[model samples]
Target: MPLVEINFDGLVGPSHNYAGLSLGNLASASHGGDPSYPRAAALQGLGKMRHNLNLGLAQGFFAPLPRPNGAFLDALGLSGVEPAGEAERRLRAAAWSASAMWTANAATVSPAPDTADGRCHLTAANLVTMPHRSQEWPDTVRQLRLAFADTAHFAVHDAVPACFGDEGAANHMRMAAHHAAPGLEIFVYGRHTKDTGGGAFPARQHEQASRAVARLHGLNPAQALFVEQSAEAIAAGAFHNDVVAVANERVLFTHELAFADPEGTYAAIRAAQPEAEIVVVPASAVSLADAIASYLFNGQVLTLPGGAMGLVIPLEAWEHPRVRAYLDGLLASNGPIRKVLPVDVRQSMANGGGPACLRLRVVADPAAIDPRFLLDEARIALLESVVAAHWPEQIDPTDIGSAALARSVQAARAAVLEAAGLTELA
Candidate 1:
C-alpha cells in the first residue's frame, strides 16, 4: 500500500523546541529564493567570528543554538544534555564570548533585548565548528530542526543523517517532504546522494538521497517521498539542477538558466504521465523555455540586478499577513521549496528567508493537526497521564491569556524536566 498516515507524536527530541525546529527545517530547506537572482546569501566572516545573538520568534518560532566555549567537565557520562541545565548553559554566557555569526541575517548582527511582556524565554547553545563550517547555516538548521520537533518527529540520525557528508542529507530530504503542499510528494530533482562540494549535497548524488528518503518513513510526514537524479535534469545547467514535485505527480523546475529547459522536462513528464499535474515554473520572471532560448545558447544575454539571485527582502516579512497565508497554504497543500544553501537557510539581509521558508509545517494526522500542533503530542500525553495519576485537580494552560503563557511554559518546562530524567529541574 502507498504510504499514508503517520504518527508524528511518537517522535520527540530532548526539548519541545526541537520538534518545531526539525519541521521548520523541512519547509525552510524546501523553499526557493527570489527568482530575479540565482544565487542566495553570502557567507559571513572568513574566520571563526566572535559570537553574536540571533533574535527570532518569541513563541511560535525557535530560539537559537549557541556553542560551548571551552572544554567540558564531564562526570558520569551525563554531560550538559539535561533540559533545564542545558538551557542555563546555553543562555548563561555574556553576548560576545566567541566568534559567531547570525545564520539568519548572513551579516554582522548583535543580540538585542527582547522587551516582550509575556513570552517564554528561549535558550541558545554554544555551537562551534573547526575553522567554522563555511556558509553552512548551522544555527538556522538547528533552529529549524527544533521547530520541526515541535510538531513532527525529531531524529538526528533518522531525520537528519550525520553520514551524508556535512550537509545532512537525511534532514534535507525530510524537510522536503514536510514542506511539500498536501496531496503531493515533493521531489527535488538533480539531488545528490553525497555531498560533492565541500558544503552542498546537490540533488545529483541520487544514491545517498534515495536511502535517506527511504529511511524517513513512518514519521510525521510518512507520505512525503524523495527521489534522486533524473536523466533530463542532468541536461540542465549547473544552477537548474533541482526540481520540486508534488504528491499528485505535479512537477515544478526551480530556476531558469540551469541545465536544459524545464519546459522540455515538463513536456516529458506530461507525456510520460498525462494525468500528472506538472508545471514548469521559474523562480525568475521569464518562462523556462524562453529563458533558455534567450540566454544559455542564443537570443540576448541579459543580467538581472542582484546576482543570479535577486534583492533580499526584509526580515519583517515573516509578520506580513500575505506571507503568513503563503506559509499556511503551502503547509496545507504540501508544496515544496527549493533554495541554494549548504543547509536549509534563508539568510537574507532583509526579510531573512523566502516564502514558506521561515515557518515549520510539522504535520500529523489531519484529524490530529490542531492550531497548536503540540496539544496531543505523545510526550505531552505522557506528561498528562503522569500528572493525572499524581494530582487530579490541576490547572490548564488554555485558561490563561498571553500574560500567563510564560507561567504555563514554566509548568510545561518542569513537566519536560520530569520526562527527561532530571529531578533538580523538576
Candidate 2:
C-alpha cells in the first residue's frame, strides 16, 4: 500500500459567474458584474486536469455542489420570493456563487504520515470570512465523506467552529522528504484579532482556527509550525498564503515578502527539515504588486515523474515581463524547479483563483479512494462532452435571478452528475 499524492480538483460549476462576492479577492471584486462564460470555464478546468494527468500524475475531481442553493435562500428567509430591494437581490446573487470550484479552500488535509492515528485527516474549511463561502462547508463535508469513505485510511471531520475563521489548504503548506514521509506542516494565519491590518479587507485565516485544526488532526506539536502572514502581503491582496508561497516535498517557492519575517521563517523550516530548499523571488525583481497581479506564487509546485520539481503557473504569470524573467532565470540557474508549465485558466484567474487554487492535494493510497472520483481518458471525455452540451455559454450578472437561467444551471449540473454516475450526490 504505497502512498502517493493525488490532486483532487473541483469541477468548475455551470453557474460559474462573477458576482464579486469575495471581499479580499481583488480580481473577484474587479470582475464583478462582468459577463462570464461557464462553458469555457468548465472546459478550461478540464483541460488543466488533462494536463496533469498527461504528466503521469494521479488526478481526482469533486463534482460541483448544487447551486442557487434553495436551502441557503430559505435560511435567509428569501426562498420562493422576489427580492424587496437591491440588498436582497445581492443576497439572492450570493446563493448562485460558484466559488466552491476553488477546492483548495474546501478542506485542510494532514496526510497519514503527519498524523497521530496513521490515517489521512481532512477537516472541511469553515470559510466564515464571506457570506457566500460560509455556506460551503456542510456540502463540502458531504462530498469528502463520500470520496474518502474508507474509514480505515481516511478521517473526514466537520469544519472548526465559525467563531474562528479557517480558509483551509490555501493557508497551509507541508514540507517533507517525500509525500509519504512524516512532514512538517505549516499553518499561516492572518491575525489574532478581528481588528488587524489587511487595510480595507479582513484577514480570513485566524490564528486560533489554525491551532484548533492542528490539534484536531492530532499533529505532534513539535512537527507543527504556526506563522503569521505578513500584513503587507495581505493588504497588497495576498489574501491567502498560497497567494504568496507554495511548498512541495523539499522545496518552498515564495516571494521575499511572503511572511512577516522571511529569514526567521526560513531558519525555522530548515531547522525542522534540514533538506528544505527555499527559493525566494526577491522583491526587487518581482514586487508584491506584480506577484499578486500575476499570481506568480499561486502555481502548483509539484514533483514530476522524473523526480524533478516543476511549477504549473497560469498564462498571466508567463506573460508578465517580471514574472517571466524570474521564471526564466529560475530554470537557467538549474535550481529546484526545473520546469515551468504555463496553463490557461483565465476564467478562474479573472475571478482571483489560479492554478493552485483549483485543486486539493491529498496523500494516500489510491486504492482507498472511490474510483469514480479518479480521472482517466474516458472520464475526461465524459466531462468535456457534458460541459459542451449542457453548460451555459455566458451568464450576465443581470441574469442571476432569471427563472430560465436557473433552470438551465440546475439541469446542467444534473447532467454532469448523471454523466459521471454520481447521482448519489444529487
Candidate 3:
C-alpha cells in the first residue's frame, strides 16, 4: 500500500480537569467547576481508538505532555508557593491543564504527495490565542520530532511565529481522490491580520498564520486554499473550523453555516477535486446550535477497510434527535458516508472535544513512523492497564493545586512513559 492516513490520538492525561480556560469553547465554559473523571476520560479515548483499530484503520497515539507545568508557573512568579489570589489560582489551573490531550490542535500536517519535498511535513501549532494552549507547541514539537524522526520519510517543523495564532488541523482540511493522492489543502482562518472580528469570541486562527504554515510545509501555492471561517460560526461556539466542518478523502461533511460563503467554498473545493462529494446538512435539518452542541460535524469521517466511509461520532450526536435524523437520512440516501458509528466520549465532550478533536491525522506508511507511537492489540491493553491503575478517578477543579494530586498526576504520567518505553519524553 502507498501512504495511508493514520489517526494519532492524544492519550488523555491524569491531570484532566475542567478549569474552563478556553474562552470561545461553550462546552468548556458550561462545564466549568464541574468534577472531571480523568480515568474515565482516558479510557473513553482509548476505547475510541480501539474502535477504529478494530475497523482495520491505521492508529497511532501521542502521549500526554508534562503537566502541572512547574516551569510555566515559575515564569509567572507563582512557583514554590500557594496561589494567593484568584488570578494566581487561574494561572495554576492553566499549568495543570490536560488540554494537550486534544492532538487535533497539536500540528498542521501536509503529506508527502502535497508538499514540495517528497517527505511528509508537520508543523506544531502555536496556539497563541489562548494562554492555556499557548504553552503547548514547544512540548508538541518535541514529541513530533521523536515520532517522525525518520528524516527520509518526514520533516517536522517548529511552529510559525506566535504573532499570528495557529490552531493546527482543527482549522485545516485536505481533500483528495484518495489518501495517497496529492490533494487540495484548505487553511481556514477566522480573522485577517488587520481585522478585529469574530464578535464576542476571539478568532483563533489568523489568515497570516495559516499562510505561514502553508509556506513552512512547502505546499504548492495553487494547491493551498485559504478560506475565512464565518463570524457567525465562531460566535456560535465553533471555536475551530472542525467544529462545523470536516473533510476526508473527497467528501466534505459540513453544516450549512460552517463557512463564510458555503457555495464559493464548495465551488473551489469541487474545482480542485472535481470528484469531491459534499454532503451539507441544512441548518433547518440540524441547526448550528445543535451541530455544535452535539458535535455532529466534529466526528471523523474515515474510509473503512471495506471501502465504505464510516463516521466515528460521539454518543451525544447519536442521541441528538435532529443530528440523528439527519444522519439517518444521509445513510438512507446512499450517500458517500454510509456508517454512523457513535462511541462514548462524554468526558472529552464535556471538556469541549469530540472524536475528531482527540486526534491528529497523518497520511504516511506505518513503517515510516516510529513503531512505539503506533497502536496494536498489545499496546492497547498496556495503555488501558496503565490508565486504570494510575489515572485519577475524578478531579475537582479545586484539586488543581493539591500537592497530593500533582504527585499522583506526575507519577501516573511517568508510569505510562515507562511502560511505553517512552520515558525519554519524561
Best by lDDT: 2
* Model 1 backbone overlap count: 85
Q: In order, how many clashes per candidate?
A: 85, 0, 0
Per-model lDDT: 0.26, 0.94, 0.93
What's the CA error at residue 153 for candidate 2, in Å? 0.1
What TM-score would you give candidate 2 relative to the actual structure?
A: 0.98
Q: Which candidate, 1 or 3, has the higher lDDT?
A: 3
Tens-place lDDT per residue, model 2, 283-330, is 999999999999999999989998998999999999999899988998
Model 1 Cα shift for residue 304 (angstroms):
31
- The alpha-carbon deviation from the true structure for residue 97 of candidate 1, after best TM-score superposition, in angstroms, is 12
Candidate 3 local distance difference test against the native? 0.93
Better of 1 and 3 by TM-score: 3
RMSD of 3: 1.2
The segments of candidate 1 whose C-alpha lies over 4 angstroms from its true place after superposition are 1-59, 68-163, 166-183, 189-207, 218-253, 257-347, 350-357, 365-426
RMSD for each of the candidates: 17.8, 1.1, 1.2
lDDT of 3 by residue, 234-353 (tens): 988999999999999999998889988889999999988999999999999999899999999899999998789999999999999988898889999998998999999999999999
